[model samples]
Target: MENHFMKRSFLTLPLVIALTTSAAISQSLPPDDHQNVASLQSAADQGNSDAQLKLGIMYFNGQEVPQNEAKAAEWFQKSADQGDENAQKALKALFR
Candidate 1:
């Protein structure tokens, strides 16, 4: 039982820290930036790696959009494929 608990804690600690950090970052955004979200989404859809990273953060944090880990991972992968270092780190932290 102790080993199982330790394993679970180890597995979840990174995810918890990622979510917490993402939430803090999201909360720091301005209130009137709704349009920014749309623009970011548009850029992300257009294969802008920076936008993809931002969208991943937003989705991961449940900021302007609903929180979705799968969606976050998808966005991160796109940016990572484009050679975005931040996105690569985010993906590693998320999946590791």
Candidate 2:
């Protein structure tokens, strides 16, 4: 009975190790900047209010990107269309 139990344990040991090692390897991969940018760009393109607001702020502050008031206003307008108070405030600030 003990030998039988040991055989079963040995059989599962490799599988358990494989699963853990694969998970570790997958977790170790570096974050993809392009993937992040693509996700943000897609959300912005789809007129997501939050994404638009973030894009507007990025433009306004040149954070990890370029600064352009016109672009900022454009994105803020999109977000404002969704009734975002912050975007509305930004738009007013930019235009006025």
Candidate 3:
């Protein structure tokens, strides 16, 4: 049970950080997902799992964009395909 909890904590830590950091950033910006969204999409299209993971979070939390779990799952899938552990964990949670 302890080990399971540890694993859960490890898995969720990235998302927590992503949310917190995104919130901090959002408080200062126009909150338009366009620029970053385009950049993130470009990176994802170029096979950058890090960008894909970040984009997924942005969509999931509606931080910089409207909430869209399906789009979030799609981006997470792309990142997970590149062996991004955080993306894989997020995809698992979204699917569940």
Candidate 4:
């Protein structure tokens, strides 16, 4: 059981780091950089899995957006539905 959890953590750590970094970068963007942020949101809206995951991370951490677990779950679910393993794992972690 412990090993299973560890493996799950190991697999998810990278994804978490990547997503968090992406969200952080977005948050740090200047107001004039709304184009990039808009582009990212547009990608997520168009069903880009990584973009969805990044938005999920952003919502989860209150980065560019407010912290909203429900919104985070929604974005994570969208990414997971697209067969993103990292998003699937992220959703699981969010639920737990």
Query: Can you give the TM-score per candidate against the true fold?
Result: 0.70, 0.61, 0.64, 0.65
lDDT of 4 at 12: 65
Best by TM-score: 1
Ranking by TM-score: 1, 4, 3, 2
- RMSD of each candidate relative to the true structure: 2.8, 20.1, 5.2, 4.6
TM-score winner, 2 or 3: 3
> Worst ten-residue run, lDDT, model 4?
14-23
Candidate 2 residue-wise lDDT, 59-86, digit = tens? 7656556878788789889999999887
Number of backbone collisions per candidate, in order? 0, 0, 0, 0
Better of 2 and 3 by lDDT: 3
* Whole-model lDDT per candidate: 0.81, 0.68, 0.77, 0.80
| Tens digits of per-residue lDDT for model 1, 48-92 | 997898788888878788999999999999999999877777787
lDDT for 50 in candidate 2 is 77
lDDT of 1 at 17: 74
lDDT string for model 4 (1-96, tens) is: 999899878776765776677666766999786545478799999989988888788788877678898998999999999999878878776655
Off by over 4 Å in 2: 1-35
Cα lDDT for residue 88, candidate 3: 79
